[model samples]
Target: MSIVTDNPFLRLSGAVQAEGIDLGVAAHYGNPMIEQRHLLAGTAIVDLSHRGVLSVSGPDRLIWLNSVATQRLDRLEPGESAETLLLDGTGRIEHDIRVLDDGTTTWLLVEAGELPGLHAWLDSMRFMLRVEVADRTAEFATIGSMAADPAAESASVRLAAAAPNGLPLVWHDPWAVVTRGGWQYAAPEGHPAADWRWSEVLVPREELVVLVARVESADSGVAGVLALEALRIAAWRPRRATEVDQKTIPHELDWLRSAVHLDKGCYRGQETVAKVHNLGHPPRRLVMLHLDGSDTVLPLHGDEVFAEKTRPEAEAGWRVVGAVTSAALHHELGPIALAVIKRAVPVSVPLEVHSHGEVVAASQVVVVPPGAGAAADVPRLPRLGVRGL
Candidate 1:
């Protein structure tokens, strides 16, 4: 068997074909059904052998991590995992990951295929932090699931468990060790199990392979990339590289509530987060889009969205607040997308979601703090300087 490098999708029987990527010799034996089942019914084991896994060690690892990431890292107990953000100096997200605090070491699980870059980023920042970073993405295979599991939420880490049928339950989580069931998963040629990368329930990869595999298996090999895309759009989850814009501020994306610590001591992007929340408004707001069937394919990433007054509105449409980071045709909902709209647009007005030549219907999903939007005067906080300028 040829070694699988950056693209772990090649390991799956039909992922390469369904995705339409040329996998060279692997194309000779394609099984789309197996790929589909990995998403919907039985347990499908996927080799996310290509994801970026990093080990951040040293006595100062905790303090060093606490300073760079948005979450309060100093307090996480072993076996605990969380969705965390890496913010720019302005408090905007640079990257996001599922951070795991294994009793002795801290693992930064980044999107698949980004390990080398993340490793370099960690290295550049290692001026005097006493932290050492290593890329171990190729060391092990990771499996995942949204399948129903009776044993889920146990003493051990449960990645995800859900029952689709009345009595049919499935357990889903990525397994790090070796396995040879319906599917055979092996680390790219040279690597052995001992070099197994960080294995956990949380998904830190940028791509959808791990989650897709779990869904395919649980769904009896009937799940497809399209179905997973629909689920993601419905969940309103951020797609990291796609949904987050370079100029975007994290708080506007709701990172404060889900990804940041307001009361924690200063870090690099503290000032930006505080200033935006206290003195200014969010530049863009994340919104869900509904696409019409006029177009067969979903909108492309970075497509513009228009809110206009004329019948076949064009030049006068509202400039894009942000673009389509990710989109998919839903099984139940036809077509759907997640976009970042400018705050200036009225949330109540109906809008047109557009790609190069395609247009879709979109409505804003207003996200206000618990008691906000209902109150006459919204509360405010004072600003102060912290680690980030």
Candidate 2:
């Protein structure tokens, strides 16, 4: 059951619910281009109620979580935010969380589908700990803003001030910076997320009405998941549902940028993470595809992506290398997508995406380059009889 099934915001905004948790508010309001523009200009709010919230309260909250998640959380300051990932024994990504800590409680923000499993795992791990994990999704709703700092804006300011329990809980994105214990896999020059100013604030479920009323009267507009997604893709951000496959490892998606703390203490799957980062390349790599717009067709998730064979005698005309994870029509970039292809796929080859019986040509924009490995840069020893000896 959808948490927001009875949400008044849907009727108030005349939002058309998307296939899943996404309520297409912009789809309802019309003019997606304008909606996207508003989002980029930091003059819009997005309903992210589909996301889940969990509260962890106890004296050992930070320490216990630090032992479980990839990021270093023991030192996370009050009101500070960070991202972490849960990996399987082989370092395959299972969960991605956005974390925020208040003085007394740690809040975890995750996909709606992840709540039950995440809560269950956390509970099972609390056999002897002082922590208490509870699913707070039913009590709190998330509102997102791309504003550089939501505290400075009118809409966010109004929402923050109206928090029934004091200031609205805001999770400012830490993706823009290379965090204290995190490493960057992308080249330092021009990572797309460098300018991303994302923030999500928690508002009481009942207080959504007040926030919605304020937005309708203000000059700022309301955007839907569509607008948020387009911007996120353009920034080369990796989402949990779209980007993650059962075999996905954090290195494949350049997740080291924000989610993994290479220097963090031991955690589950840490060995595989360290092994892959220090000794081997991930089997797959994430890429951004700029599709040819002449076809007027966009690839959907799970659409096959192929590499066009150049030789005349090629056995298979096109080899399947990957599948599209997320696709969107950017207001400025037209059609674009993020796909996870085999790491061996040559970056220079022309690509094609097959979706809905239509083939769309694509050009690769490297996100996780083929050589993204050995992030630790450990020096190799000289040969036994080398001159240096």
Candidate 3:
């Protein structure tokens, strides 16, 4: 709904800036399908200057962050990449922070329009702690790529991550595998995400001018947010920016696979995270939809999803089941989307999505299984011992 319109990359020929939530950055360099192929081959880069960057420094940064977030950061070693979520009092996701502690300052990368609130919240929580928070978004920006490991490999050494007397501030994506104490609620490690070698490098804002020159050169290539979103959907990745709402919890989207640590100590909403995970099931589940490509419809955020009722009570009309949160047309997969549906909705049922006054048929591939929660093993009471006789 917001726009960051004056990006330098917009000066490049054929560069089309994206609108809506990803408003400010280039959506594609003329052809999105070609961009998708370039991204998949690890030869393209996406300018993510639209993201927000922050820094948390001082002696108590790690423990302070650990106490307020869902991930364990107390022992986060330098050069280690982790993801954490800040939850509300009831354990619903409030903020998602991509964390990288370089043994000096903890660098946080958040979605566009999230920095001000997160910065204020962290500042208010300081309460005499030996930590300080600063918004560095103006000084730094993000560049994302499908480099198996950006810091280790030389995808584009010219855009080396900013290192102010420490390790490069590149966040190697932990979503490719579960972090310490995290759980996997989706398909296991060998799933499509295994092939998702993504990383984000924090570079100096001033360096973007030079980076763009290289991008426009004959040796480099650039892709758009459309390409990135399509690949992310194919990988079954849950993006906190658009996938979540007021009712969102970690289990509903299988975010426990990386952003949550079940064994971690108390934090806001930890109880609900534990309860639904260890005793009861989450009320909803996430699924990937294969949209019928015969139509020209592309669903957007909050597009209604319905179950086609073929029963005798068909007069009741199609039952609303969920809504599409993100959609993209992959170069290979055609039209696809990530939708959140009620857990009680049978996975085998036929589905459809309504957008722009057109209804398109859909089929779901489960991400978070209906029986995902209730993970703890508890022994049954021994038949109550016949009323204690």
Candidate 4:
């Protein structure tokens, strides 16, 4: 039987449950601004039980995972964490997974909506390999926070994860810096992820009441899903569930910085991965849109983004260049969003977001630049003997 994921945090006073895409979880605890501050201070915990948990075990788990994923996992050490993407044959993203190895077993965390597809794919691919895959969502729940290290001496509360084989199940995000065999497309000097210390800890389902007690006693703070979403946008974090579409490739959102290993061995979509990074550019690019505050409205995903034409026709209609992938009303930034725009759009040009019968004037803060990828730099040798004719 599937376990019901009724969130325990919703019992708290002023804890408003989020609706729409991420339902069944708290959206905020009365004050979103205060919740954001608490998260940054590492005193707040976000309930992520709605996320899916899967496991793979046996001797060839890492090798099997490495053979099919975008990141190298064959040599992953115990307690180490990584992230990977499962792409379709044509190079479009299908599933985004957070990977953590604990010696005896590897825990895979994914969006709840993607659990079935991911599990089915893994089970089918296990042919004769010494690997096992199972859905563990019934036995485990996910907790998210900005805690850099839960094992630290100065940690606010002593929290532990399920450790059937002695290694705790904590998946630290590797997005703060570019990982090995990866490339960075954003301007490196002033990237926003400098202060992003996000991590997810997996605890047994029965411990929900224990965590609730801490929040009740004021020993630990509890924030809502909106708090995390706001911070994620501010940090320029691109999550596959929100940022990716049917046509998404790693380079488009600067996702190659962490989720992709360019030098990895052959995988499902390596041909397209190599071809785009070395010889071509992603058709679309990612940008942060600083929305006009006068409108006082948030743009939803798939909202059309337009740009004024820079061509000879001065009176043409506003052309649609891209659409918003995710947006949030940040505590500090007023209204900001992460959008995927055309690669040909000029970085300096201002943008407009059409949402809720209003057009919000916006400006682009480049994330994945128009010229991202094509790092090979192979010079064009003058053709045979016809040099400079």
Lowest lDDT 10-residue stretch of candidate 3 = 150-159
List clashing residue pairs in candidate 4: none
Model number with the top lDDT: 4
211-303, model 3: which lDDT tens digit per residue? Answer: 788877856678899899999999988888889999999999989988999898899999999999999999989999999989888998999
lDDT of 4 by residue, 2-39 (tens): 45566788899898988876787889989988899888
lDDT of 3: 0.88
- Give lDDT tens digits, candidate 2, residues 54-96: 9999999999999999999999988789999998877889999
Best by TM-score: 4
> After superposing candidate 2, which stretches have Cα over 4 Å from the reference?
21-28, 152-157, 161-167, 310-316, 376-389
lDDT of 1 by residue, 68-154 (tens): 876677876665555557777877778877676555667776665455666778789889877788764444333333444422554
* Predicted structure 1, TM vs. truth: 0.68
Q: State TM-scores per candidate.
A: 0.68, 0.92, 0.95, 0.97
lDDT of the structure predicted as candidate 1: 0.53
Better of 2 and 4 by TM-score: 4
Q: Distance (Å) between predicted and true CA of 245, model 1?
A: 2.2
Off by over 4 Å in 1: 1-13, 17-47, 128-130, 148-226, 309-321, 367-389
